[model samples]
Target: MYRFSYSEILEDAPQLARERERMAFDRALHLLRTVEARGERGAERTAAIAFVQDLWNVLLSDLLDPENALPEALRSDLVSIGAWTMGEVGEALRAPERSLAALIEVNTSIRDGLQ
Candidate 1:
């Protein structure tokens, strides 16, 4: 018979939580970029806008909430980057090439700002 150690399970919780948050953030970012690249307009645009708005709302709230388990610096960075990415996604949906170029520029600026 195989035995499961409770200590090992407890030790893995924090790392697992971190990984889960990271994955969620990444998925949200990917969806934003996909919506931008799709050049969605009309109802699609509305849906995409709503999606990003919801994502940012949740992310910012989580970052600011005292009960959140993430590190403060990481929380702040995630909020900042999520906001910047949302803007870029909006621009891309509106203006494609120009927006894509602007996204690159904005991403670079944000990275520099974080430093």
Candidate 2:
């Protein structure tokens, strides 16, 4: 078995955290775009709704978990994004064309805020 150095882990932590956040954001954006393209009036739309809901649930849980190792500010930001994403997802489920723009706007706003 290979031994991992403490210094290596510490050095990689920020990059790892950034990558995880990027992956989550990308996944959410992909799901949103898929739903938008499919329209919001059938089984596909419902599935997309479920997908976004599930993703946000996982993000929120991670942020709120006591054992989560993220900094407090980062955790708070994740929780905020999860809440905003859930709202956008709900709007998209209700009205795809109208809500898609709003969802995209919210996503962009959140990304800007993160930066």
Candidate 3:
């Protein structure tokens, strides 16, 4: 069996942050696409949406933390985006036919910013 450790892969602060954000965005993209195809119905879609919400919840928590190292302005911006994401998740859940472009664009933009 192959075992992977994040601590070993991300030994520096910069690399760690970038890789973490990239992974989070990738997860969001995957879940979003899954829900899109499933039309937001059934347990699978619900679980995917919940997972996406949890990702943003963690982002929001990190941005809100007083000990976070990010600049105030950047943290504020991310918090705002996080709030938008939470709302988007609710909207997407309510309207199964809604476009996931917004969610995908947000994740992609944030992921790119980390690079």
Each model's lDDT: 0.56, 0.66, 0.78
TM-score of each: 0.47, 0.60, 0.79
State model 3's lDDT.
0.78
Regions more than 4 Å wrong, model 2: 1-27, 104-115
Off by over 4 Å in 3: 1-12, 37-40
Candidate 2, residues 1-115, lDDT tens digits: the string is: 9964433443568667556555666666676677677665677666756766886686687578776677899889778877887887777667645656566566656545544
Instruction: Estimate, for each residue in 1-115, the C-alpha lDDT of model 1 and write its tens digit.
Output: 9853333432568566445445544554455456567855456555645655665665576567676665888888777877777776666556534434444444435334433
Candidate 3's TM-score reads 0.79
lDDT minimum window of 10 residues, candidate 1 = 106-115
Off by over 4 Å in 1: 1-38, 86-115
Given candidate 2, what's the lDDT at residue 81? 73
Q: Top lDDT: which candidate number?
A: 3
On TM-score, the stronger of 2 and 3 is 3
TM-score of model 1 vs. true structure: 0.47
Give the number of the best model, judged by TM-score. 3
RMSD each, Å: 8.1, 5.4, 4.3
